[model samples]
Target: MKLQDHSASLSEVNQSVDTTVVHKSGWRKILAFFGPAYLVSVGYMDPGNWATDLAGGSKYGYTLLWVLLMSNLMALLLQSLSARLGIVRGRDLAQANRETYPAPVNFVLYILAEIAIAATDLAEVLGMAIGIQLLTGLPLMWGVGLTVLDTFLLLLLQRYGIRKMEAFIITLVAIVGISFFVELVLARPPMGEVVTGFIPSLPDDTALYIAIGIIGATVMPHNLYLHSALVQTRKIKKTNEGIRHALKINFLDTTIALNLAFFVNAAILILAATVFYKAGHTEIADLHEAHRMLEPLLGTRLAPILFAVALIAAGQSSTVTGTLAGQIVMEGYLRLRINPWLRRLITRLVAIIPALIVIWVSGEEKIGQLLVFSQVLLSLQLGFAVIPLIHFVSDKHTMGAFAIKPIVKAGAWLISTVLVYLNIRMVWSEASEFISGNNPWWIDGLIILVGLAFISLLVITIIYPWLSRYRMERSARMHPTKVTLGSLEAPSYKRIAMALDFSQNDEKIIANALAQGRPDTEYILIHIVESASARYFGKEADDFETRKDQEQLDTYLALLAGRNINAKGVLGYRHRAKEIVRIVKAHDADLLVLGGHGHKGIKDWIYGETVNYVRHYVHIPVLVVQ
Candidate 1:
């Protein structure tokens, strides 16, 4: 019994060790795999989300948390579809849609999506600048000035691979996540109220308005587009098991980061609720009020400072996502290649103009109104962007093996419809502030300018397709078949040579079939001995050789085995250079072709005997194929 007991105890100890090993290994796996999705999460936590959450919690307390849960699930389903499309096709979302849709429809959808990305980007810039003001006590204008510093940040992104950028953003996300985690615990938000918020009860008119803001904020279109495009940056191959893993990793990544986002969003709402709900705080505005009011409630130094730090992180990280999204939108839609720096500068300048103007003219009194307005526009534009993602992902011609199932399509459509309905409701509510206000002179002036700007931008966004089609038609009429890239090839050689280490005739057959321009060119086969004497000695003779001789033999054999081309090689040395020149002279050879790495410089040419002898002595037109 004692021996048996010892054995059982040892077995238990072994089991415990095995469990410990598994736990450690699992943690390593999780960390190693935790990329891509966190990058996607940045868009979810963009300044737009913070502004919406601030508005929601301040106005309705815990009444609209349900909007976030539903919106995030919707975001996940849509982004996943886009990501799956990318994985299967190995092309970004915009390009795939362009190929799949009719030219007119594709042009329209591309322009609308690009505008949506730009609008989303504008939110990121404003949010980052706001966070800068909160964190550094800079004036709003100076904080906006610091947005230019993002150009430097973009430099770091290019110098280091995007993996480094992902890490930097993930750290920022962790800081934001931890700040909210602490704030949520300290605020001691009512569990019962939080639960009820998710139950979807009808609120008063104020509650419904706040609810719309929350939904709009949570469901930005660019996040779907960014996630879908970003997944292709990783080394996801187009194999079945590999694709399945990519999908799984994307989901896990999105879930982890978005779950943190959900908490961060809820924390902002809960903080606002705890500090300002129904306290007769009718006109509290700006991140300043958010901080100062919360200071008295959640202690002084940590909570408010953390709030600012989180805002800064959210805004800065989002700028990177916004920049990349802008690049994709331009490349995929406009087919115009501009410097990334120029693109970012243009976006920042335009986006910050409104926010800067708001802070200047209306002061903090209207920032709340501005956040709601921006978010509602974002919600409205998202449908235009997301509906096509669903359509493209479901199209059998496009997605092929990875076409979204019927149920997923149904869910995506339902989500898009609900969001469209919410945006319409929100836009109607927001339009009232500009149109129906009691103020007289400045109100009318502000209303006219803002309305014109809003309508003009919206009209441009909607009518871009017609404009694009007109331009395309006009351009086609003006020019025809403008050849692109390397069209200056001489007539395809009747005979071609492929240099081989161990290649077979299979490639020669294909290359021969694929040879362009001249199909009936004479094919010549030739092999060279190391020296003219080697032809008499056979393969097993004395191998005293010259540089030109060795080169001629290899080049000749390759030319023989490769594509059908009229070319041959000969064996000779000492006068070998003279001999090859003599052969070219004798055959009246039109061209000599040599295969190589992309190097044709004097450095590679002079060091190797074959290249050295062939290049230096031969006078015929020599073509180098890389």
Candidate 2:
């Protein structure tokens, strides 16, 4: 089996682009490797990071700048490992885990990965909403509702192609960088204090808590999944020399992009330290309050405007990448593919629902706390992703000649150990406070039960490699079934069923089906007029839609006629999947052929389940050509 053939589809964006440096040299060669790191960098300066930076700077002045610096260094190291894993192994982190671990272990890791993505999305959603609330006088809940529209933005940009989308993301990152640069200049932070802030120090428990949040938000788990896949989008030769060149260029890309992210994060903390901490307004932790106070503190309108603009840009860029990460995780771990738009909607809604509830019930007062807690949740899930990445990239069996050197391996392990320790300490502190504080007995019991379960799962994950090895050995000894030559010599397909949505992809579907068609084989083309949309309008509207659908089907039939293929078009109203299955059964189709657009995220949940349903209901061999 070819492992490269099973690479996640998310990396197919720019797969055709040649990243080899045949004639190119210096900066020009480096430019080809620029995109993936910027995409990863978006997570570093997202709203969750913003909330922590603001809280740290305001409450403790520039004391926590060392944490930001430390976190960025860790991010730089981890992100490099992630990219190397993809480039060397031709597999994303999630896919690697799925292939390496046992079913039960993989399932637990999948759950943790999804939770990390959701937590990351929650921060983005809240940040965008708060940015909107700052620029306009809208309520927090309304602003959150508006964020759903970003799904449409992603859909629009994606249609233009991956290069275009990368350019757009780069522009957003530029906006954020320039916005913070201007703010940094306006704030004019003390050079002496800023330099001193770089020295490591933690004043108290609050500082430690916020410091952990910074690390969690900065070294995002999804970015590890995302970067690994994103690196594969560029075409690199599989030779040892080509791999080394690519790794070097990628290291440069990671360093440059993450330093830029560091500047943005540092500027946020410095701005807070200068304006709020110096003025004795150290309690300005809320995003809205930070935005509102900026104008008065700087005594200029551009200060606040720039602040809000940067905030929105950060949030928007992160959410776009966040959506892609969600799709990669789902496809990588579950081997389940859905429409990209639907996948985006599902993940966005998952994040948005919780945010909307918090806004409506607890109000914006709780948002700051919620953002911090979300990062902490991300911190909890970080080990599951990071540990596996380190293990794979360092393993000679997996990486071959490209496996990490001993020095690099030692540093990576050290970073992972520090992160794991921080996360455990944060959880322990939170649990201690919860148990000590006044609360209901049931609530305390619930906390204890949840903590126990988490510990149990952690233990299982630790021992999973041994379990996987045992299972592999046991399975290796089992006998396999064999097929006879007569069965292999049967006819390819007697009858085939094709489903069409009458979209631009319909022709592609028809072309693919024709490729499989024989003179004796029959083909049934299907179109379903959805009942819900028909009911939204009246019978006249439904009739009009049916007429349009029929016209499109006729064009398909005409194409089939020209090819001299035995084919007929079938139309039905109301249910799509059931109708397609019924037509397939009625025609006695030996094979079902359909066009898969690979719609995912939010769109998958809403209307992209048709193919899934057909696959489950139909007993025949199904050929889904994407």
Best by lDDT: 2
Q: What are the per-residue Cα lDDT tens digits for candidate 2 across 1-626?
A: 11222344474573645677589876776787779899899999999999999999999999999999999999999999999998887778888887777788788889999999999999999999999888997888889889888888888777666777889999999999999999988999989999889899999898998998989999999999999988888888889998998999999999999999999999999999999999999877689889889999899999999988998999999988998898788878877766666888888899999998888899889999899889988988888888888878877865888899999999988988898888878788889888999999999999989888777766665566545442322221123466455656545788888898878888788778777867788888888776566644523455667778889889888987897888888886666777789889988888888877787655765775677778878888888989
Candidate 1 lDDT, 1-626, residue by residue in tens:
01121111111111111111334575554454456678777777777787778777777777778788887787778767877766665555655445444566667666666666666666776677777777777877788777887876675564455567788988988988888888777777777777777877656766666666666677766666666666666553457766776677767877877787788887887777766774645444356677777777666677887888888888888888777777666555545546556877887777778877888998856765776666666676676677667766776754576788899888887987786666656555676765786778888787668656544544443445334432322221123458567768566555433222223543543353235325555433223443566655544445665444457455654764575544444433333334445555555555554444433333333434354456556665555544
In TM-score terms, candidate 2 sits at 0.83
User: How well does candidate 1 score on lDDT at residue 72?
Assistant: 79
Per-model TM-score versus the true fold: 0.66, 0.83
Query: Alpha carbon lDDT of residue 59, candidate 1?
Result: 70
